[model samples]
Target: MNHRPAEARQSPARTTEVGVRYAIVPVPVLSLETVARRTGLHPDLIRRFVALGLVDAGRDTSGRPVFAPTAPAALARVQRLRTGLCLNYASIGLVLDLLDRISLLEAALRRAGMRSDLPPWT
Candidate 1:
């Protein structure tokens, strides 16, 4: 019953002009309402977060904001920092920036074959 070509039975990888094999994966883009529902936060609160630059979003063709799939997790992190640490939005932004910087530095250290836990002087 199989009349398809042999290539159709294999993985969905495609060969480019450069002979590079790659799979096309579709990334999900969430709307503002969807992000709010997933994060259990109000749409207005999500808008506030967006205004404060706490979450990253892109405007769709309709001029509505769209978020990455990670937006919910990012919102959760923001909530945790807000309640658990009792930090304001501004402070949370600074903390997030520092955390991101630290992560990048750690990744660079890892790529350089150095232990991130080691003191800088060491």
Candidate 2:
């Protein structure tokens, strides 16, 4: 599953250009191993994120997992949510579920010119 974020897929030349000003740097790609190293997590835990549908994988025909450049940072957040917040895996599942629902709602809210401070927002 070699998926890319919308902006990256849209522009191959520059990630995002500010008209004539400059281009926003696109994040780099990270393999699962690197993600583990960067996140200080066991490789098994990284795989669990994929199984848990927490992080999306990059484009790859092989079964190996490749992560987006931003994934290490994102996984770090999940790590905090687990360790710092003391949430168990089951709790994590529920929280993730709520977050997904909130994301869907937020898109609708944005289209309606309204916003709320909520889940996966920060």
Best by TM-score: 1
State the lDDT of candidate 1 residue by residue for 1-122, as single tens digits.
Answer: 11122233334677899999775754457999999888899999999988888887777789998877778888899999999999999999889888877887899999999998888799
List candidate 2 segments past 4 Å from native. Answer: 1-28, 115-122
TM-score of 2: 0.58
Lowest lDDT 10-residue stretch of candidate 1? 1-10
What's the count of clashing pairs in each model shown? 0, 2
Candidate 1 — which pairs collide? none
Candidate 1: misplaced stretches above 4 Å? 1-27, 120-122
Q: State TM-scores per candidate.
A: 0.76, 0.58
- Cα miss at 116, model 2 (Å)? 3.9
- The alpha-carbon RMSD values of the candidates against the true structure, listed in the order shown, are 11.8, 8.4
